[model samples]
Target: MTPLLSWLTAVLVGVAPPPPGRTRELSTRDRELLAVCQTDQFRRVDVRIASIVEWRERRGRPYRTIPPDASLPEGHIAFTFDDGPDERATPKIRALLAACGVYGHFFIPGTRVGGPKARWAIAELKGLLAEGHIIGTHSATHPSFTRGVVTSRDRRRELDRGREALEATLDIHPVLFRLPYGEGHWDSEVLFEISRAGLVDLHWNITSDDAKDKAPKEPGFQGLTADEVLARIERSLDFSRRPGERLGHGVLVVHDTNYRIAALLPTLLNRLVTRGYTFVRFVGPLVEGRDAEEDTGVPRRD
Candidate 1:
């Protein structure tokens, strides 16, 4: 083999091979191209340090980024529940959170948490907020903007209804919104609606994906056998986080209304508490106290 090629191979093998099917690794030719564009490593690190210093100076502290603030620290994971205020299930979700001495951000359907339903559940939500839990909106009905869930007009109506329901119930409305099914087809109208509603798009970094797996009678989940669901939730947590390390920040996307989640919440929260994480609600930057401006169109209450 040519000495030049041998050296190149050694350098490539020295660090670490990229994972299979991952295209992010530096290809030999691409890396060689970079040699012409190379900047000093120490200089790069210095630039990063300076950038962080300047950012901290202006923003006080940046959110959801590496080299987190000394105050916020790193490795803290936030728990956020979606599509809830489930009369039967939400109480249990709340109780588990209380027992753990940690609270989560709850994304509620405005209809469920409003009107007569609000009469019953809003009190519980108030207790949650009182205890530092956060509430965000998850649309008025559990409709989806995805092509599979419902028609476009129906989807718009659902969001519009949620906005009204939230305003009627909470009075302040919600400023945070998450898509149904943990994913959405983004477009100009979606962007316009989000902006007009004055809502921040709240989403998850970790989802159990158990909502799609409702077949408890099947192998993975079982009827009344909540352990299976609990186990999967645990596994999701494990896969999403590193143990004994400071994560500084992460958002765990979990469900409340799903019966399987009834068993899952307690165990995961307990495990998380034991891990030295203080459960903070994964609220976006536009919470009520964070704002002093007029309503933007999005419902602010969950």
Candidate 2:
């Protein structure tokens, strides 16, 4: 192995630190060496992977569920939007949620807020906060950390930069993070980075599959229609619930960047309400000590 690959292999196996004078940046040659490590031919290393939820539960910090009430017959259901702060779709989604009198958790990519559309993105994020929605980091540039292509330094940078950008801009310290593409949820390295950053990683048990791209000649040529998305969500809910359980609880994920989902959000929300599902916010280490019901309440916007 070359010195760089050897060093990386050692690092992956928990044996060594970065070589001297190579801590801050990778040289062109070093980049090529790293690329070699990312190839499919490269042998995958075995590391202790851990599920964040199980880890939290083991520590007695099990995520709290929003129980059913008289008005909402079904148990808790939290809505999470990823890969967003879109110029068009996001605002419409916010408006739709506002109309439905429910709040959502939006996981935004740091680059979107700090990039060229920083002004609009910042304003949009602020608006979401003002309207009582919760926001979390989705990482800077949304890289897939479990792919072996991401270095330790890259992981730290992704987590820290994304968090710092939001804190600096919003003057709020976010305690929640969701992995890009929902990858690395159980990777020890990824979990360590998240814990080191003092952020709890949130993973969804239910998904709308709204982010999925439709194949050529698919019914909804661009994306899945509202009915299709609803069907997928219902099926997931059915599978997750017990045989005799009347209500189900889970975090449902969608993308705010998808206009189809945004536009049809009301239909989904109404259907969910009619089906006795109560919209709730994620609660646990992410919002320690805060009641999910209180968190779900309307925010007092100035």
What are the lDDT figures for the candidates, one per model? 0.51, 0.63
**Candidate 2 collision pairs:** none
Number of backbone collisions per candidate: 16, 0
Alpha-carbon deviation at 265 in model 1, angstroms: 2.7
Worst 10 residues of 2 by lDDT: 43-52
Q: In model 1, which range of ten residues has the least summed lDDT?
A: 41-50
Best by lDDT: 2
TM-score for all models, in order of appearance: 0.60, 0.68
Local error of candidate 1 at residue 197 (angstroms)? 1.5
**In order, what is each prediction's RMSD in angstroms?**
20.2, 18.7
lDDT of 1 by residue, 1-302 (tens): 87546644655666322112111233344333333222221010001111221111213422222121212223456666777765545665665555445556677777677566668676666666666566677777776666544554665666667666756665545555666665462343443454345454556555566566545333222233467656665565555555565443455676765645655555555455445454444333443344322232222443
Identify the runs in model 2 with alpha carbons over 4 angstroms from their true place. 1-74, 215-222, 283-302
Candidate 2 structure quality by residue, lDDT tens digits, 1-302? 88868866776676754232311232354343334333332221111112123333324433311211111223567788898877546766776666555778889888887768899888888888887778788887888888743787888888888887787786666767888888877665667667766666778777778877874332222358767977888888766575578766667788877666654665566556665565665433434355433322123223
